[model samples]
Target: MINYEEILNSSVVDIKPSGIRKFFDIAEQMENVISLGVGEPDFKTPWHIRQAGIDALEKSKTRYTSNRGLIELRREISSYYKRKLNLDYSPESEVLVTVGGSEAIDLAIRALINEGDEVIIPEPSFVCYVPIVKMAGGVPVIINTKAENEFRLTAEELKGAITEKTKMLILPFPNNPTGAIMEREDLEKIAEILKGTNIIILSDEIYSELTYGNSHTSIAQIGEMQERTVLISGFSKAYSMTGWRLGYILCPAPLCKQMTKIHQFCIMSSPTVSQYAAIEALKNGDDDIASMRAEYDVRRTYVVNEFRKMGLSVFEPKGAFYVFPCIKSSGMTSDEFCERLLKEKKVATVPGNAFGECGEGFIRVSYCNSLGNLKIALSKIKEFLKENKNG
Candidate 1:
């Protein structure tokens, strides 16, 4: 027999599969299960944006856009950033629209990392970062965020991890799996630590617009740090455009050139209709974002408060839609707690270790479902916990 495993890249075998998917597999088989396991928003893409895409299909503008993406879309993205984030980029050279934030991150990592270089990614973060870093021939060094700090990465922690091999740091905020965000003051401390290092920053702001109270801050917004930062954002979260697969990369002119070459070779461009739809999203999507964010805020508050009343220790989430709650009170490991909750109550959630090590005692609950569904799920969870209590 042919030795297929031997021929496959050994690195692929070494990487751990995402723990988030396992609960989903079990949850999928059962009927009437209430899942707070997924990180996606429960909203549909707004009608106007969807209509623009339909119009494009009718006009038959179905051919591929230029690898650098449409000039009009880039211009619109530039304007959108300026109006909303007060950031500026030259559309002609600095913006390369991506298929999604996933591709944007892949392009950024592949463009910057040489073999054996290190990418420092703060943990209890998105599951994709470490694997993507490894595939690009880089080492993934994880830094654990603490619950007391609301999981924000501290400057001291970031500074301690840098070494000569460190090439980049992915600042993932309004973070996944834990709704952590670093406000301007929080980022300034990190900016100070990175000033002397050669480390480039990948500021993944996919959840920027979803922050609850404070306005989102980009590393690029800080003076001098802009040169070292590539802003990664997309319409997936804020505009309910996950299925649209639209995102972009904004970097300094030199890095933009490097990333553009890889994007040209790999993706060509994001979908043409999606690009048109994104233009509608960027220009007119603010109200849609605000409305959905308001709904999420309502649910976020509800879940965190409900979890606390259940006697679970929950870190206060200022952004994104997840609540990272400690489940150690029941003497069950995060994994054991989640598995039991799903099997017994038909309520699905992801274990904290799914994100990284320090996530051991906790579980992530996304508030991306209907209020009625969340209330029902919480009741089930409460009953399960009370029944399982060791005391």
Candidate 2:
């Protein structure tokens, strides 16, 4: 047999495969499984967004767009940023569109990290950050965000993780799985720590439009930090355009130049029709977002309150669409708890450790499903908890 290991890069081999995938591999074969495990919004792209793509096709605008994306699309993106986040970027030089928020993240790290440099990432935030940092030839130093602090990376935590070789800090709030976010004051504290340091900030604001009570804050909004931060976002979460794979990165001029280099060579351009659709999204997707967020708020209350009524310790998520409920009372590890729940109750959710080591005693439950589905899942969960209760 061919020695595949000999030919592959060991760096890729060393990374652990996503823990979420194992559950998916099993769930795919089972019948009657209700998944609260998924991360994407269940809504289809709003009709107008789809109509824009169809309109583009009829106009024969199917050819490759500029490597940085269509001019009008980038212009709309810049406007959207200002209107939504109070940050400014020049459409001409600061924005580079990519396949998804995932690609924007990879390009941001790759464009900046040098080999042996360390990238500080807040966890349990997202699974992609660690492997992407390593894949970009940088060392990933994961900074644990404590649940006590609502999973916001405190200034002390940022300072504690910084070493002489620290190259970048990934701020992943409205954090995935945990649904944690940082307020302006918290971000300012972190900015103060890095004020004189060389560490770049990669702020993933994909969930910027989904914050419950407070508007999302960007680290780039801090004085003097705009030059050092790369803001990443997309239409996937807010606009329910997940499958469209449209995302953009806003960086300093020099950094955008560097990312476009990789983007040109690796991906020539983002999907052409998607770019056209995204222009419409930036222009008119706010109504869609408002409606979706309003609906999520309702479901969020139901799922979170239902779980609390079951006597499980539940943290009310302030942003994103997930809740991290502690499974410690069941006397089972995250994996053990999720496995038994799936097999016995037929309700599917991801174990918290799938996010990072800090996620150990929790399991992430997505509220993206319909109320009918959620009611069924919660009823099943209550029954399972009654049997498994150690009290």
Candidate 3:
């Protein structure tokens, strides 16, 4: 034996595998399983966007792009942010494209954190933040966002978590499992708390275009907040370009320089074909976005109503394609509920604890599947709940 464990990096070894993947693996082995587990869009990439990638291929645009990505793509991203979020950036210096928002987040954290620095992460949010922070040799300080406050990170909770060593705060809004979004007023309050602090805000706004009722607000849009916020977003959610793996970061030039260095060594560039497709998406995908958002809105309403009718307590999700419904009423832990439901009903939902400890009593149900499939899954869940009433 080579003693692989002895040679492996201790920090990497200590990290647990993603909880979301556990149920997904079990679901995959079962035939005819209706999965509401993965946080991926079921929609195909709009034809125009696909054609753009094909067009790039036909033109022999297959070489590695500049380490910071294609200039035209960066410009388009800059314009897109300005048009959609009222934020501006110099594409040449302030924007850097990465494989996905996941990579952008990883690059930013790695570039910023020093050993033992504290990074504040609010949960039940995305699963990647804490692990990524720790991988950067930083301490992960968690602030549990409450369901009572609609899972938004309040100014008070944020202020209470901040300490002299706080180096960064991972802001995951239009959150993954919870589907909570912070409006402009909410950002203003957070901005007030972070006004004089050195803490960098890593704002993950991948679900910005998917918000219902109110428009999405970026903390970078708040006064003085832009200087400290690194905004990460991509075409994965809005343009259904997940497999294409295109994402970009918008930040101050100095931070962008450091992140680009890490990105340069780790990933020379995002896929050239994907960059071309993303350019097309930013330039002409408005109609596609609107249509998808409208359909998701319909699905969102249906899922929320179905969960409530089953007497499950669900906080109405205003954004993202997920609903975190409380499974506590069934007297089962989230893991138990998801496992039993998968085994008996053949409908797979993710345990909310996959997102954080605060998610223990809930189950994350992604509404990203087709209406027919969602209806089938919901019906099965209803039957499961009825059978396991005292579970």
lDDT of 2 at 5: 92
lDDT of 2 by residue, 1-391 (tens): 9999998999999899999999988888899899999999989899999999999999999999899999999999998888877889999999999999999999999999999999998888889999998988999998888878889899999888999999999988898999888899998999899998778999999998999998888898889999999999998999999998999999999999999999999999999999999999889888999999999999999998999999989878899999999988989999998988998999999999999988999999999999999999999999999998886
lDDT of 3 by residue, 140-257 (tens): 9999899899999999999999999999999998899999999888889999999998999999999999999988889998999999999999989999999999998999999999
In order, what lDDT does every prediction score? 0.91, 0.92, 0.93
Off by over 4 Å in 3: none
TM-score of every prediction relative to native: 0.98, 0.98, 0.99
Which 10-residue window of candidate 3 scores lowest in summed lDDT? 382-391
Model 3, position 290: C-alpha lDDT score: 97
Q: In candidate 1, what are the lDDT values of residues 60-81, reduced to their tens digit?
A: 9889998878899999999988
Candidate 2 TM-score, true structure as reference: 0.98
Q: Name the Cα RMSD for model 1.
A: 0.9
Ranking by lDDT: 3, 2, 1
Lowest lDDT block of 10, candidate 1:
261-270
